[model samples]
Target: MPIRTTETTVTLDHPFALTSFDSVLPAGVYRLEIDEEEISGLSFSAYRRISARLHTPAIGVLSSIREALPIDTRELEEVLKADRTPIILPAGE
Candidate 1:
């Protein structure tokens, strides 16, 4: 999910460049258009914050480790096959 506030029609050939300020968009359904034609629809959600720190002494070590990791295609397939359920987070919990 992404955060989008305003809905503006842009040409598909030249999509509007996104900026940090555009990141302030609220969560909602969005319709993407190109030359007055509806191209796609997207739902944007609030940004999720993450806080983590990794301490390593070797330079470029983390890069190598990340590259060595294997991508599980089955996980992606399962996500795509799963039913579409609205993700609801507890408010101020």
Candidate 2:
């Protein structure tokens, strides 16, 4: 399927999950890049692929603070997958 990119904002009142992502998104606004596609066959054909990245937290002393924020527990497979970067602070910040 061919994919096109579209920009949208996700606002969560509670933790939310994405098919490809393991993390539960916290309550907040998240900027996302959505991919859309269309297919044709005997019946209906439509599919989409989307990808979004969150910034990693700091190490050592600041680690615990980062943990409180909503995100996946595992490490990112590809560290430098994109040119753009996201910045997330501690829960209170």
**Top lDDT hit:** 2
Residues 26-67, candidate 2: write the lDDT tens digits: 445554444557554638667644443443232222334343
Candidate 1 per-residue C-alpha lDDT over 27-77 given as tens digits, one digit per residue, 9 for 90 to 100? 222232112222235373233322111112122223333111121334323
Weakest ten-residue segment in model 2 by summed lDDT? 75-84
Residue 80 CA displacement from its true place in model 2, Å: 29
Model 1 regions more than 4 Å off: 1-64, 80-85, 89-93
Against the hidden true structure, what lDDT does model 2 obtain?
A: 0.43
> Which residue runs of candidate 2 sit more than 4 Å off their true CA positions?
17-23, 38-93
Candidate 2 is scored at a TM of 0.33
Candidate 2, residue 26: Cα displacement in angstroms equals 1.9
Best model per TM-score: 2
Clashes of 1: 2
